[model samples]
Structures are given as structure tokens and as C-alpha cells.
Target: MTTYSRRAPRTLLLALSAAAVASTLSAVPAATAATAVPTLTWEPCASTGGPTDQECAELPVPLDYRYPGGRQLTLAVSRLRSDRPEARRGTLLVIAGGPGSSGVQRLTQKAAALRKEMKGAYDIVSLDPRGVGGSTTASCGLDEGDRDLVTLRSWPAPDGGIADNLARSRRVADACARNGGAVLRSFTTANEVRDIDRFRQALGEEKLSAWGISYGTYVGAVYAQKFPRHTDRWVLDSSGDPDPSRVARGWLANMSAGADSRFPDFAAWAADPAREDAGLRLARRPEDVRAVVLGLAAELDRRPKASDRPGRPLTGNRLRQALQGALYSDSAFPQVARLIQQAQDPAATPVLTPDIAGALSDQVAAVTMGVVCNDVRWPAAPASSYARAVAADRVRYPLTAGMPVNVTPCAFWKGAPVEKPTRITGRGPSNILMVQSLRDPSTPYFGALRMREALGDRARLVTVEHGGHGVYLGNGNACGDREVTRFLTTGVRPGRDTYCAD
Candidate 1:
């Protein structure tokens, strides 16, 4: 659910920068000891797309922060310098979404739009976290079949059985432990915070302003907490609950309600008479779309249908997964509606979404699993505990069908967390701004409220009366983008929490 893609409205499918100079390391906790800053030599980016002015560099960070002088790994970094140097105040770091998302790539994709928005207020920069694109990498060496999105996401069997999930979870855990060495184990949120600080030092900047999205918001929050003095205007967009006790676990569990909250938007869109022209409408009334989808999924459970893909069939769980992905944005409604129409017809072959059609790259699977499993410890409860939770969740939230609470590699992950998850509190500078959609399928508004509560007076919330994943520059609501841009450019925030009407 924390995946990052440039698809419109920022799709939530599990898919799986820089500079340099020198600055003194600020005195902080010894646990995050200062390390030698590497000089960043920038060159034209290798990619031909994106802003032509974008430049690339690499920064060397310690593989393990406890021993900063020990083994080193390369972090790919990129930057788009402010065109109007006189207007530039400082660097703005773009923290990407996924534990596996490439920050360098994100900067590339959004550089043009961001440049226009900032109007030369800051030099925008981003970086690839360890095990991400163009950075030092590791692999769990998982089998091809196990890397499929549906399989990796822990979808229960057709009969609501988790026996297969348990086996797969253990298998993935074992494979990661066996093949992923210290490099993979080092991919925790704590380490990423350290790496970001190190990058700040390399940039010769005393402080960093950031726009952190989705999982990046977690990283940004942790960074702000761990190194409060080094933060400038911070923006957390599409954030999850910052409960240290239940970091990734709580985020995943909350998706059930998130899906339910966001589904009505898609339902209304699908039931619109406008969709009839494209042969994509599912029901005559908005209320009937849910039953139509549920009935089709239930029918698929009874008898799988042949899909456009040869070996892969359109099964019940796959349809459900597609629905979950499509719920993230209105742009995806037509594809899902068409697939539903195809499945209802016996002669037609349903086309699988790209996420369900193939396996993720081994590196992506490794990073996604590594960060979540290593960030915090999952409960070591008996399988029956999970079974009961899943059963209850299914009836309570049929859209997710218990997938949110199902067993994952984290349940069987080996080794304890190197450090406890960072508890985000209101102890830091009151410079944080959070923007969240009311009905975000991945990180729901309710979860964002929990983060807001934890941050207390240190942060103010901008609740958008919209439905989708990303908010600013995402749903294209003028009100939401205005508030965020105002804060970023003028260093002025709303007097209190505010709402932006859709």
C-alpha cells in the first residue's frame, strides 16, 4: 500500500539525489554520531527525461550508523537548482513514498511542476534510500512466483483460509534472512534518518526543508524528532499513524477502513451515466455498484475466469486487489469497471492490472519487506490469533476481506529491531505542516488524525475534503495546493487546522 508510482493521483500498488560540499556535524545523541561528509560532485543526470537542468550525484553513507567509519554504501542523489538564485533561501528535500521508492526518480518526475510552484524559492533535492534505484542494493532472492503482488500482499485463500499465507510468510522470512545480509538489515527507518542527516551535512547546509509523502512522512517525522535543530519548514503529505509501537503494522491494518471510506467515490463514478458511453458502467444506481462488485468477486471465488494473461487467471482475490488499487484514484475507475464488465461476460477475457500480471523485481520485494519488517517488531502470536482477527475484519470491512490483518513476512521475520521505532511527539520545532485527504485508501484520514494528535501543537493539519492518496499537486484541488504552497513559499502556516473543500 505504500508503493510509489507517477500514475495520476499517485497510485498505491505495491510495486514495488545530491550535492556536496562540507558542513560541521551538529552535536546530537551519540547513537547518531557524526560521520565524515563526502564531497558531492554533480554531473548531468543520465536520464534524458525530466527537467533538463536536473543534476545527479552520489553520497557515501555508513552501512551501519553505530560504526560510521566501517562499511560504506552509495546513495544516489539528484538536484534541480533554483533558476532565480536571488529568491533561493535553502534546499528543499523531496522525501519519496515507499521504503523502496527512488527519491532520485521522484525528483525527476515532479521537478518541472515543483519548479513552477516554488518560483525559484529553493533548490529542490532528493535521494534514493539504500536498496532503491541507483543506490547500493540487496536482494532476498525470492522465487518469481512469490514476488507477485497478490502473493506478496498476503491475500487469504478463496475460502478465507490463511494456511497458504502462513507458509508464504515463513518462506519469505527465511529467504530474506538467508540471502539478505547486513545491507538489507540496515534498511530500517532509523538508518534512513541517519542517511538523510548525512546527506544534509554533505550539502554544506545547516538545515533542510522537506516535502515528505506517504512513508516519506514517517521518515521525515523521525528525522525531525532525531535531529530537531536541522529541520526547516517540513511538510508531511498523506501520512500514516506515527505510533511507534505499531509503525508499519498499524498502517497496514488501517487500510481496511481506508478502503471502505474511499470506495463510495469510485462507486459514484462507476455508476454515473457518463461511463455508459465507454461501456464501463456497472450499475444503474450508486448504491448498487457495491453489490455488483461483491457479487462478481464472489462468483470468481466459485469459478475462476480465464484472463488476458495465459498462466494467470482472474481469481476472486485478484479482482479484490485491483479494486483496492483502483480506489486510490478516479483515473483508474474506467479500467477496473471495464475489467468487471469483461468478467461478467463468459466470452470475454478479463485483463489483469499490471501489478497482478507479473512479479516484482527481487530488489523491490527485498526493500519493501526489509524496511517494514526491520522498523519494528511484529507480534509473535500463534496463527490462530491472526485467523480470528482476519475473520472479524472480513465481516466488519468486506472491501479489504481481512487482507490488512493477514500474516506477513514480518510475523516470522528474523532478529530484533536494531533500535526501537522513533516515537513522533510534539517535542520538536513547531514547523510541521500535514495535508491529508478525507478518504485516502492507503493512509486514511483517521490515521492521519492519530499522527496529528501525537504531534500536538508542533503541527497543524490541512484536511482536504477529497478522496485519493496524495493531496497537494495530486487531486488538483486549488484550495489544498494553495495552503501548502503558501506555507512553503512564505513560511506562513494557517493560524489553526483548516479544511479545503473538494
Candidate 2:
């Protein structure tokens, strides 16, 4: 994930300038903090079907480090104690994907799988970042329609005009300024790293092990950089380019290339003879799948197919959304192809999953926007500048069209960044291990190579010659999974970059 450095001066002309000014005044460098241990109280985890061994706790962190004794927000945390105390090495924190994904929920979902693999080697734990899940949250107070995922993702107009994008960007940024409070401002990557250190202190662990995915990889890298001594085994999965200059902005822009690299895997699967047996085939030939999809998208662009939902239809945007969703996992390939097959036939109707259309609540959107916008400043000159980039992007990356490079709320965000973005270098410990899919849709291979370069000899990368995101355990690539597990459990890493062929 890319983010702008919060180091600029706040000026009325630019929203990010104010944010930068605020960050500068309130900034407390993570490494310079006084070494103070935090007291933690554990209670039974709260959820509809929470496990018997699961427990929850709240860690109080200052909203503004400058005013350490001022207002505090609670970070919702959960843990699954190590089953084998004799074998327990330390706490393993699961840093979740998506600036918006809930870490607590991820811990709950992956606890069993982790337990089976780690075999009581460490306590599995995670926390919902501030402004997510059960944690203290801030809202942009966006209207219901604008809060929808489709709108937030910046899907182009039916004719491919980006007028709506520019308007929405300004409107959303304004809402965040008026409604989002200090809690939202404090939700930067640097702050998350600081909070992780606080959690480490609270847990009484001399060193913390972690498995961070997607956006989490950048966070984990920052933690390892900021608190090198406190790190145990660190695993960064499906990482975006950790370019400090552009930060999350670069990650978003790179999606154009990432989608292009990973789309062929989807195309091949959609056209395979095996898909005919599943009744999910979109094309008789692999090469035809792209044209078929582009044609269908154009048709949808002209006239959307009605879905079961009253007002919602399967538009070009929805198709793009489904495609983006499907690209995340190989298991989702058939589902997207099926949607295409259904949309292609006049008699058949497409089904929309609740998980697909739901926009995060106002709080979730706020944090997602806050982290990306806060970490980096996006170009806000004019809609035409984005339009030019979008038009070029659409020609090169038809799978994603221009959504990834389009203007977002961050373009009109309220102030410059408040702190310098963490530049990941080889200066940290050599304990970090990265695993990536060569053709990952979200975090592409070329960008991962840059991360490999940035880490220098401080880290080693295991590249899985496969498609999709989250290589280890997500895709059925046993080689990558086993290698990562061995490294985390036994502290043995491949001496150099290695590839796992499918």
C-alpha cells in the first residue's frame, strides 16, 4: 500500500498540508519513546461463536503522542494462547490485509489453521487497527450512496468519463475533514507500528513474531525497521512496492500492471476444457477469453443486466468488481466465469453475493481512506490529469480499465502528511522473510522484486510461480507453504531468492 509522507507544512490551499503540520507537531518517533511497560488485562473473547480458548483485551494508546497523557483510544485485541508451553517461542501476531481488513476477525478465522501448522510454537494473536472492527472508530459521515463500495472504488462512468470521480473525491475528503476526528488522524502506518510496539510491551514478550499480508506487509516492514530488536520471525506475504516517496500511491498506481500480469491465469482457467465440465467456461479458446470479457463489459456498459436485487444490475463496474474479487483467489475463478456465462445468456440472471456489494460501514471507509490518504499525497491538479492517465491505463490494462489510477478522496484529503514515510532499507535485522506470488493481482511480481532489492541482504524472498494473492496457504502451492512454515518455526531461510514452480 502506498502513502504520502506526512511531513509537509499545512496550508489552506491543500488539505494534506494541514495534516502534515499536525503530524509534525504531535509526532513521537517510535524508536525515541521512553521504555515503559504496559499492563494488560485479558478477558474472554466476544463474538457470536468465539472459541473456548480465545480471549480478548483492550490496549489503551494515546491519540496524539505529543499529548501522551491526553485522550486515549482502545485497540481491540485477541489472542489464542500457545497450546504447548514447552515449545512456545513467543507471540505470533497476524497483521491483516487491506488497510480496512479486521485483524481480530483474521485471527479468529485463521487461528485453527495456524495452530495446526505452528503446533503450539507460539501464541497466535492479532488486533483490529484503530477505526476498524471493535476498535475505537472515526467516520467521514458519507452519505449512504457514496459510501457504497462501487462508488468508493472509483468505477468509471458508463461512457468512461471520470467527472464523478473528481466530484466524489472532493466531497468525501470534505466529509472526512468535518466528521473524522483525532482518532482518524492518528491512523498512519507509523502509528500502527508504534501501537504494535506498545502491544509487544503489554504482552510482556521480549520479541514478537508476525505474519503480515498485503497492506500488512508494509506495516510489518515498518515495525521491523522501527523496532528491529523486538522482532522475532517476520513473514511478509503479498507485499506492494514499499516506495517511501510515493508510499501507498505507488501501490495503487501499480495495480494497472498487476492486473495485466495476473489476468492471463484467469483467462486460461475460464477457457480451459475442464471449465466446460463445470458449466463455467467463458470461451472455447484461451485467447478468446479477453475479447469475450471486454465485449461483455462493453455490452454491460451500454445496457446493464438486471439482477435479483430490485434496483441493482450487473453493470460494467459490477463485472469489473467481480473480476477484481475473483482475482484474489483461484477458487473464485469459476464464480466469476459463471457470472459472465449467466450475463451472456438472456434467460439466465446473475447473482450478487452480499460480500461483493457491501461497502464498509462509514468507519471502515474512513480508516481505509485515512491510511492511504494520510500516508501519501495524491496529485490534485485537475480531473483531466487523471483522465489522461486513465485513458492510457485503459488501453494497456483492460482487465482493470482505469479504476486503479483514478483520483480518490485522498486527492482532496484535508492536509499534507504529518510524518516522513518509513523508508524500508537493509539497515534492519536479517530475520525478515517474504513470500509472494509471481502473478499476484493485488501486489504484482515486478513490485515485489523492488522490495527484494530494497531489503538487500537483510531479507530473502520466496517467489511462487503462480497467480493470485497471498501465496502461502491461500493457493494450494505446497512448496511455498512448507518453506514459509519451516522458516517461521525453525528460523531457517533460503540463502537467496528462490522460486516455487507450479
Candidate 3:
């Protein structure tokens, strides 16, 4: 579920020595060298289609680095081998976005595109981060209402109150503490990085080149920082701020600017005459589209519309939630605009997408909450501060309604981070290339600039002047895609920051 915003597994600790791993490493061979390949056992696993090529394998890793022979958890792994073995350069790991997102499914969805682009240049691989889809799981067993996206995201009240948010955050935090097990306790970025190294060892790659997107960019950056020598060619797409101190908290907060940056694109699309016949045109002018949306949201706040569904009328929060969803992609903008048009017209009926304001699985919410909670501490006064922020944000960027800076369970998250969050310094190998959209609704240009500054001489940034979450292969921009493709294939990056005009 890619919301306008923003998984915890076991805290498996591994102290990876770059030289030692490179010398005769257990997981991967040294960079620029080939070694004996370790055997990988592939077996069927879980997905929408019952018996796909999905496979499961275990990577034995120390539970605690201090106690090397301690207990271990089997990390579920999946792979899609390249079609052309002769052209295969190496294994390119697809690091999933959410700390809670499934890497296996991502591999399946993007395999064709990756294979087509690279042309048997690499075997695509991914793993379910602990406590995520198909991985070893944990549960908070939250009630249905608490798991709803509107409630879970801690959106301010229609009337601008946050009392419900305060109560919900505390209640959800308590539920997780009581019901979530040790596996839930282990969900942290440091542990995920450790598990990745162990998986690298299990795969028998000397150095792992990776394509990390969204939240995965942070994970990739940490991996690069922790094990600089283990990297081959790293690609971070639609990246967020890499301020390790705030981690996921900062990423969540960044949605404010992200949505602001992206909404104009949607506005222009909704205002286009091309959308008139589609019944998706919200207004005649681009600015009018924004006004109509905000006005409708405000009107819904005052008097919610009765929908085809029984009690689920289009409410203010519902409209806001829809806006959040629409900002993700161009394809979705029309649907959201249609939702608005239907709500405005009494005779018309709007088809509500189940995802707009539904309850995510208790498990999904838990993992989403756990990772942010466990990674870093947020101020407990989020509700109070958020109310103020939302009011200010509504004035500053009315498109998002200040939900981006609002509160969440992290404010009341029970667990403390096990290890220090990795600050992505420029001290690593200079082999990293970042491809970012200038107007990404989720990871805005401001945050990406922070990452660019942090990476210093280690990275070359290719800025795609587009409007979307992902730049490469997402927005219809040849310049951005070519820059990334060239870098991934030939190991050549732009001499400096380059712009790709849409």
C-alpha cells in the first residue's frame, strides 16, 4: 500500500568486517573477484498465485554478534534468474521499499522490466524483511477500527481536533507491547542490514549491486555505510531523507513537502480538457482544481455525502485519504477526481476503492508501526504538536491538509533502537548513483538534496524533472532512464549532477 506517506523483524546482529568478508567471506566474495559459489536451495513459497516460481530459503545468522553461536532465524529468500547467463554480470538485489515491504513480490513484478533493460546482465533477487509478507511474522492483534489507514496515519480531525489520534496512538502502542512477540522486538534497520549480509553470504555473491527504492534507499544506504566493500553498483530511486537519527520518523514527516510537490501535476491533469470526456475534470483551470478539492474536502467536513455504500459516505477524511492515494501515480489521479465529482453530484454514484479508507491487515499496520517505533523515538506530544503543524500546513500546502506532519504510534512506540542508526556519510565507495524525480510526492527534492549532500563525492545524482514517486522507468523520461541504465550497465555515472527535463 503506497500511501502519500511512508517492518520490523528480529534484531539479528552481525558485525561484518569489510576486509575479512572480502578476503574469504562467508556470504559474498570480495569485490572485483570471483570465488566458489555456495549452493542455494530454492523451494516454493507464498503469493497471490499459489504455485509461482516463489521459493523459500534460510540464511543462518547469529542472533547476537556478541554470542556468535546463539539462536538464529531463517530469513525467507526469493530469486528470479536471468534469461541470458552469458550476458549476466552479477546478482542485482531488489531491495523492497517499506521496511515492511516484501522484496520477493517486487522481484516478480519488476523482473521483466529489469531483465529487458539489463538483458541477462544479472540475476534479480529479493528477500522478505522479517515480519513482512511471507517472512517470519509477528502480530499486535489490533482491533479493526485501529488499523484503518485514516486512523493509522493519524490524520487530524475534520474539525481540526486530534484527541482521537492521541488515544489511538496510546491504545495501539499498548496492544503491540502486549501481543507482539520477540520477533516484533527484533524489527529494526540495523537487524535488517545484518540479515541482508547473511543473505548475501547465502547467495555466494562476492559483491552485491542493488536497486533500492523509497524506504529501501535508506536500507541500501545503511548497508553501503556498514559494509562499503560489499557494494558493487548501488542505485537508489525515489529516495527519502537519510538522516539516520530520525530515520523513518523523518521519512514520514517528509510527506508534507512530497504531496505538495506532486499535487500540482495531478491538478494540471485534472484540469485538462483531455479529462473532460473522462468525467475526471475537477475544474477548468489548474488552480481551480486545487480549490475545488480543498473546498470539497471542507464541505465534506461540514456535511459528509451519502454514498452507494450504507454508512461510508464520502467524509472529509475520506477525501483527504483519496488525495493521498491519488498523488502516488498519474493513472490514479483521474479516479480520485472522479470520486470527487461523484461526491459533488447527488445524482451520480461514486465507486469507492476499498484501499482508500479501509483497514490494512493488523499485521501490516503492526509492521509499519513497529519498524518506525523500534528505529527511533518520536515526541510523545505528537497529537498536540501535529494539530498546530496541520493548521500551519493547511495554509502552507493545502493539498495535504497537514497529515504528513501529524502523529503516529511511533510517538508511543515501546521498543528502543538496538543499535545506532547509520548516518550515510561520504566515506563509502564512490560507486553509488541516485536517480530522483524533482517533484516526487513521497520523497521530495528537498530531502533528496539532503541525501545528495550526505553522499558527497560518493554519488552522482541524476535529477529527472518529472512528477512522480519513481523516476527511472516510471515517468516518461528518456534522459533519466538512460542515465541510470548507462550507470547500471557500464558503471559510468554523470560527471556531475545532471537534469533530465520531462
Candidate 4:
């Protein structure tokens, strides 16, 4: 889930007055008072073999909303205008997953599919949040070892010991405090929401429709809560619980259940007769696949296997982390199965997932840690509390190996949340629709139901009887995709909660 890269100005005259007033407001510093809706000078984006029509621009937003006039950070924004302008009704924002994902890249990746589906009904757009690709960035100056996917995820030792985890957590926290300045501190869900509003103003549109996936769902939900009047038709895919008290902490803890729910799908796939010919089948029965995977992990725990990467062996934790990554989609099952097969052979060298093989870039690590650590304060309880949690979690959910409940840098984070997390409520417009898989490895269906509950009467949920982290255009579920497309194109939602069979 933390793969990091997994991934306005309507009434011109009145708008001018609003900008003038905002500049002079006592809350804004005098040195940097400027129009809130700066005109965007869009130009053709540098060719990256993506959609030829895609255009890019830079939007300057305050690094700190509390001091809007003090400093500025530029957000990288991109758009693919409607081919049929006559059919266009509004702008649709595409929100990418991951607190560190590049919205600009996501736009490029999805532009063609979205364009084909929407059929020029709207000009699709997205913006890289601060500290992402093509945007202003900050670093925590972390050691390469600390930034590795396995280490950043806080996976425990072979015997389930967390002593190493505790030390790393404290060290990461101290490094962030010393090296990550206000820029890192500026990364939070609240700040991101504010940035969206600023982007809306710059777009010169009265409202925006959106398709927010994964963690983007949380960002979209907060935006709807803060600026209900500015939303037209909002779609949240692969949503998680919107419990403000827990926030990212709750999402992480819920992964244990999510992985359990989703693993069966992978197990079934691995056991299928079709995989036998490819030498990918792991077992004779669906139930047997679980034992095969678990047994392999335990064996690795006892004696790690050398991998394709020199000096970077495949340990139990690395395998577990790889499984977690693969569970996000059915398409990845073969890779995980192959890794499993290779691990079982003494002479075979397993190929590591790129993420598990090396360290994350400092900017990527900074934003991922910044948002989760800054959004809410993790419990600063004694290490024993975390040890107990990890121990219990391991027994309860072996697939995750207690990593979900393990202590992280958040517990020792130097910065406190600048503002309270936004509580998503039903008070907003009933223009929101959520699409979720029944068994999401990153965001379980049970957790998504919590988000459905929090939104109350204002939202409609289209549950897909499928297994994966994303729904809607993802997973190839015609039923689910139709429901979302109908809502976006026609603004017509199912009168009650609905289900889509796989």
C-alpha cells in the first residue's frame, strides 16, 4: 500500500474581489500577498510517449495555508482536454493513490483509457501533490538501508522480534526532524485538500468531478467535506475507513484482515489447473496453497535464500513483503508464485520485486512518512506495548506477520499535526459514489463499510464481489465500471446500496 509509486474563477468580477480580499486578510502575511487564482499558462508537456494532447502547467500554492503569504510551492498539473468540446460539461480530476504517487504520471497512464470511457464528456485533469514528481520536494536524509521497502515497512526479525524495529523507528524520527524542514512538515492530508481547492480556483471552474483511487479516496473525501459546494460527481474507489482518530494508523492495522480476505483469491489462482502447465501451480487444492506459502516463509525465516541480486538475499520478511505487494492484483499472482517456486529450490535464484531489492529515493520516503506521520499523532506508548501488539497480530494474522501493528517512526515523529484531521460526514452534498472490491488487500471491504457508514446518507456504494485493491475501471468488472460511468456521465446513482457480481 505504501509502494509510494504504486501505483475556478467562475464569475470573473466577483472572483477578482474574492482574491483581493484574501490578499489583505490579516491571516495572510503581507510580504507574499497575491491573487488566489493565478492565471495558468498551459503548454504542451515534454514528450514521454504518453497522450499527445496532454498539457502541463505549474500552480503556485502556499507551503503553509496558515501563512499563505509567507512561502510558495509549485504543484505540477496536467490535463487532457475533451476531444468533443461541445459534449463537455465539466472538469474531472483524477486523484492517484499513495501519499507519494505522482498525479502527473497517473494522468499520463490513465488518460487514454479515461478519454475512451468518458467520450469527451469532461476535460480530465490531475496534479502532483507537493513533494511528488515534477513538484517541489523535501528529503529526510535517510541512510540507504533505512529506506529499503522491507525496512521502511517495519517487518520484524525471524523470531518475530521487534527490537530492531524500535531502534529504526527512533532513528528515522530523529533524522526527519533534523533534515526534513517545513517542507516535509507541510505534507498532510489537510494541506493536500487545501491545495486541491487552490487548484480548483486556478482552473476557473465552479465545480469539479473526480475519480479518486486508493489513498486518493481519503483525499477526495476530505475535499468533499471541506468544499461540498464545489463538488459535482465524486467517485472514491478502493476506499478505507475514514476514522479521523486513527487515519493512516487504522488503515495499516486493517491490512491484516485485508490480506486474509484477499489471499484466498491468490491461493485459488495458484491452485488452478491452468497454472500447472506453466510450472506455476503451487498445490493441488486451493486450501493447500496457503500452507505451501506459509511453510516456505517459515523455511526462509530459518535459512534465507540467495536472490538474483548479489549480496541481497531473500529473507522471510522480504518474501512476506513481496506477497503483500502482489496481492494488490490478480495479475501479479504468477510473479509471486514463481518467486515461491524458486525459493523452494536450492539452486534457484529468486528474482526480487524492485521495491524489495533497493532503497526508496529520499523524496519518496519523505512524503510517504510525512503525510502518515503528520496527519495524526501515533501513540507514544512504551516499546512493550508495540511488542505485545506485534506478537498478537502475528498469531492472529500470519500473512502480515504482525507488521501492520508494529511500531513505526510515527510513534517518535517530531512534528505534530498542524490541523485536526477532517472528519468525513453526511452533511456534504449527496453527490458522492464509492466503488470497492469485496476483498481489497490494501483496503478491506470491512474497512470500506466504515467509510460508507461515516458518509451516512450522502453516499452510495457499489460493492464488487471481487478480490483486489481497486475497483471501477480496474479489475475489468463491467458491472462496477458501468455503475461508476453511469453516475459520472448522468449523475444518476442507485437509490440504495448495490452489489455487482464478479
* Winning model by TM-score: 4
Listed in order, each prediction's TM-score against the native is 0.93, 0.92, 0.89, 0.95
Better of 1 and 2 by TM-score: 1
Q: Which scores better on TM-score, 1 or 4? A: 4
RMSD of 1: 7.1
- Badly placed stretches (over 4 Å) of model 2 are 1-36, 46-50
lDDT, candidates in the order shown: 0.87, 0.82, 0.76, 0.87
Query: Candidate 4 — worst ten consecutive residues by lDDT sum?
Result: 1-10
Per-residue lDDT of candidate 2, residues 1-502 (tens digit): 1111212232321332123223434455534333334456889875666557899889887786665556878999999988887787777999998898899999887777788889878888999998889889999999877787778889788666899888998999999999897778888998888777767766756578899999999999988887777688999999888999888888888887887888889889888888788798888888898899889989999999998676788888888888887887899887788888889989998887554555568988899899999987777768788998888888888888898988899989998888889888999789889999989888888888888788888889999989999877789899999988998888899988898988
Over 1-502, each residue of candidate 1 has an lDDT whose tens digit, in order, gives: 0111112121111110111112212333444453445778999984677888889998998887656667999999999888987788788999998879999999988887788889988889999999999999999999998898888889888778999999999999999999999999999998888788777766766678999999999999989888787788899999999999999999999999999999999989988999889998899999999999988998999999999898889988999999998887777888899899999998888999876777889999999999999999999889999999999999999888899999999999999997889888899889999999999999999999999998999899999998999887878789989989988888899999999898
The TM-score between candidate 1 and the true structure equals: 0.93
Model 4 spans > 4 angstroms off: 1-34, 46-49
Task: For candidate 4, write residues 1-502 as lDDT tens digits.
Answer: 0000100224562464255335324465544444446567899994676898889999988887656666889999999888987778888999988989988898898877788888878888999998899899999999988998899899999788999999999999999999999999999888788788777777776678999999999999998887787788999999999999999999999999999999989999999999989999999999999889889999999999999988889999999999999999888888989999999988888999866887899999999999999999899989889999999999999999999999999999996787778888999789899999999999999989999999999899999999998787678899999999988888899999999999
Instruction: Give the clash count for each candidate.
Output: 6, 25, 10, 3
